[model samples]
Target: MSIVERMKNLSEKECPVDILRKEIAGSKCSDCGKCVFGYEGVTQLQMMLGDITEKKGKGTDLALMKELCALMKTQSLCEDGEDVADAVSYALAHHAQEFEAHVAKKGCAAGVCKKFMTYHILAENCTGCGDCLDACEEDAIAGKKRFIHVIDQKECIQCGACMDACDEDAIVRAGAVKPRCPKKPVPCKRK
Candidate 1:
């Protein structure tokens, strides 16, 4: 399942009554991340979980995750975490480009990670139906009716609602690059 789908299911089943909600420690997480012999894998998982729970804006630490996966592949005690470690290793070995994109460009080729996605409107494809404007909660999309819309890269939260709303297939991905919009071309300077 996608992260958005998982989050939606959790929100629906776990949080039914919002009027009065109390702390419920359902699962016993011993906080002992000893499945992997090294602390790197579990530590990064904990950090990622914390960020997800807190709704942190930052993307995950890809370099750290990669290192942790490598460590866990050899150091893990049992099969519990070894499977994931092996999967990570497989991905690193075969899908290095995908990981590199996530780390270097902050973009997911699978389009599963929202934090690394930036929605862009294609002028040629966009019918300018104003669907994206209504879908965007961050007010990042701006354009007049019958005109091509533009996504304000800085203001976009990467929720992907705009992409979902567009029927003309105009909304596109630009691989969310922070501190610098990928839509703008940067001049290269030779050293």
Candidate 2:
């Protein structure tokens, strides 16, 4: 077959892969406020069960999906069902492994990976600048009236989005090497 034919065949045979990244790849539930509410929202479990059942027919198993969905419900959601279904899809496809690897509340209160959330600046050391906010992928930084910065622990995803953007050497990872995850699904780090 011609190369074009091969490519077309590949696309056709490909399993249903998400084209738009509304959620992380392996973990659909990233503990983001959106998912805490959206996927399992303030609805009856019966309704959630029905939706999961219909969605499962596509490939996911409904009962199994609900079990996982129940788990996500504990976190609180962003209150839009379809808004965050992709995260549920990711969790369905990849399971809890991604959750363990990426979404722990202890170190990553901001939902970003340790690898990404390496650096932080002591506020007293800050030089009242806005550069860090520009670099942060998580948008964790909130500059105060004096241009002092504070990291919003909840919204952070340690993608090193800020360190590269700082000029005053305010953000540093505290010299700890976050254990590298090898090919662990990037399934949404944080924020």
Best candidate (score: lDDT): 1
Per-model root-mean-square deviation over C-alphas:
12.4, 15.3
On residues 100-174, what C-alpha lDDT tens digit does candidate 1 reach at each position? 554454455444455665677766576667899999999888776676677887999878899999988877776
lDDT of 2 at 56: 23
lDDT of each: 0.52, 0.42
Tens-digit lDDT string for candidate 2 (1-191): 32112222323222221211212222233333354454334233324323322222222333454455455445544323432343444443543332232322223222223342345665545665667877776667776434556666567765676777776675666322432221211222221
**Cα TM-score per model:** 0.50, 0.31
Q: Specify the poorest-scoring 10-residue window by lDDT in model 2.
A: 15-24
lDDT of 2 at 181: 26
Error at 63, model 2, angstroms: 25
What is the model-wide C-alpha lDDT for candidate 1? 0.52
Q: Name the top TM-score candidate.
A: 1
Error of 2 at 156 (Å): 0.6
